[model samples]
Target chain A: MPRVDVELPSVLTGLLGVPRVVPVEASCLADALRELSELHPTIDVHLFDETGGFREHVLCFHNETNTRWLDGTDVALADGDRITIMQAVSGG
Target chain B: MGTTAVIGTAKGGFILRSDDRRTWSVEGPLFKGWKLTTTSRTPAGTYLAATASDVYGTAVHRSRDLAEWEQVETGPAWPAAAEGGGNGEARKLKQIWTFGHGGNRTYAGVDDAGLFASDDDGVSWTPVDGLNEHSTRSGWFPGAGGLCAHAVLVDPADPKRLWCGISAVGVFRSDDGGASWTPKNEGIPIVIEDKSCKDIGRCVHGMVADPKDANTIYRREHVGVFRTRDGGEHWERIEHGLPSWFGFPIVMDVPTNTLFLAPLESDEYRMPVDGRLSVYRSRDGGDSWEDASAGLPAEHAYVGVLRGAMAADQDGGVYLGTTGGQVYVSSDGADSWQTLPVTLPRVLSVEVYPS
Candidate 1:
């Protein structure tokens, strides 16, 4: 079995009152997100759009590159693969 | 003139007395410190005002004679809860975004949260259930700012039918007098990103459902104005004739179902468009629209209407207050308009009461 590391973006870190960490045994990234969303109920509404996918404001990165630009949720992760979720910023 | 009208302004609130539906006089700038958001007259002709006052938290006031006001307790001074572990004060009480009236029931939507109802005039309030507290409350998403409920429209014929607007979250309907809500965005368009990112519905600002025809609803989203004929089941976009896609206030005439909105240039952050202030009107239920500013100021005026700053009276009259501190009045049902007094402190909202 492969173990995955999860990280959060600076914008989303403090939003939830509790510490953000979850362990899952999913084979792919989508399965991991789905599982993590269920484990942490608070993130279910904030992170997912009406369509049930990661919100546009949220971005997931595998290592330093955006996982979105990669193979998407289907991208497989081996041991030590780090997943980070970041929120986009907009201002005047 | 025989109709008495209460108008909300930026610096001061005003009460206009009119008879024969013609001439008018401004009556007030009451409550010197706070800015007025919206005003609704109860069944007994008692005026109820939802205000953003610094001395008081968000409060509602009752005016028996339409001249003297008595303060009434409203709700949580701020949007977020004390235990929410978030910056509740940052948003504070921006405005009393909209008003809903039915029988003895009166509701006001405060910034950051929702419909606070007053059963006996505007003296006291309790949070309406289903519309405000969904299973999704824990995760209610905020737009650029924190979460807030702006628009509240109650069916005059059926007070049980309620519709509330949440910015960036679409519209919610409560058939059981706001006990529970169902998202009415099935036919509404949402901006979905590509494979990786998902998109929510557009941020809704102001909405008006026909007082007579519950099925006809008009909404002004951050993107543009849309009309829903089937009680919000499906929406048809009507952005072709407007100056800008972004705007705040939308007023409707009950008799004709005509819709009026102030259009600004496209700015997701809700900024004035190219410094132009234009009011557009749709006569046939938003199918087609026309610019309705005949005697109003120039487009370069940079006057932008805020969330609750535009209102329509029972006499086919429309009024709008702007962020630049200005007010415009349309006596002929928003077909044409003229500037009223000079601008004042950012006008948060506007309401007109006609007797």
Candidate 2:
């Protein structure tokens, strides 16, 4: 099993009750998110929309690569990979 | 009673505690960098703050003490974009404009124009479908402020009666506990040129209900100030004593029949009239107005006060937060003013809690 460090923005740490960075064991991006959601269930709605897709305003970067532009969340993860979730800067 | 002024701002929320109304201690930017658009207190003493981020959607946070906050997971949400609702535009909760408490329910007016209610002491919320799914919603377009349902007034006498004000769409009243709604903009002048002047296209800036009589209401609008004696069945222009017709935020002292408004130069230039900071007050129910600028800046103050950025405490203490990040307080019912010691981000809403 591969492990990755997940970084959450300040906007989410208050709701998720987790530190800015946390390490979780997973084989892929989807598995890591699932583990993150398990750790903090209330954060799912903020990350994904009703359709279970990444919310329009959310941006997930897998070490500076936009995850949405990738082929799929099933892209294999490796040990020490970093995943950062941020909201697209737009409105106030 | 100790007074606490809870202010919502572009960056977060601040709580100012005052024992003598002259000295104060401030705590906050709670919710730290998130935009706190509005703040209110439930009858049960729960403080609710409406928070939003361009990325995470809108949420409400509740606190018993002004320090610790717990975000409500079940905040307002619109139906799926594919649901064919919201007049073909995706309904998103951009801002939570106002909160009203009546009977055992708490109501929230939200941007993208919708109403929501919480029966569980601000812990959760449910959309008021009657207003969200109204038949005439298609005609309710966005104004300069965006299509925001910014005012909620729940009649104290009848828990079932309520009124909601939205930008450009005007006001709507519900007689059956929000099960249905009817437009209530009989005499409000419409300022948007794209919409029909004869219809419900009036852009209401801010509204406050008379504490003594829920039937009487005062509103500052894009065109002018207005009042309704019969709970929105009819409204009359009441901009006689003001320096300018355009303004935002209206606060009323029901005990004295006094109303306060901060008039802007014009809709195109939404700054204080003549670049001077002045708050106008009407003592006789909007018949005439008088400048209430004592202790405020005399000139070169070109800031604008937002719609939800002014509030009146139960004891008649008034406060106004301006876009330039100044908080002005008037302990003697708007007769004079004193600026708070600190400067903050753009103030969105000002609420007073007396304990």
lDDT scores of the candidates, listed in order: 0.65, 0.84
Q: Pick the candidate with the highest DockQ.
A: 2
DockQ, all models:
0.01, 0.49
What CA RMSD would candidate 1 show?
Answer: 15.3
Summarize candidate 1's per-residue lDDT along B151-261 as a digit string, tens digits.
777777888887888876678888887778887865556642223222234467778888778778888876668888888777788777776767777788877777888
lDDT agreement of model 2 with the native = 0.84
True contacts kept of each: 0.00, 0.34
lDDT of 1 at A9: 45
Best by TM-score: 2
- What TM-score, over all chains together, does every model reach? 0.70, 0.94
lDDT of 2 by residue, A1-92 (tens): 98899999877897546699979999989999999988876677678764578888899999879998998899789898999999777658
Q: Give the range where candidate 1 chain B is weakest over 10 consecutive residues by summed lDDT.
A: B81-90
The candidates' interface RMSDs, in order, read: 15.2, 2.3
Give the CAPRI class of candidate 1: incorrect
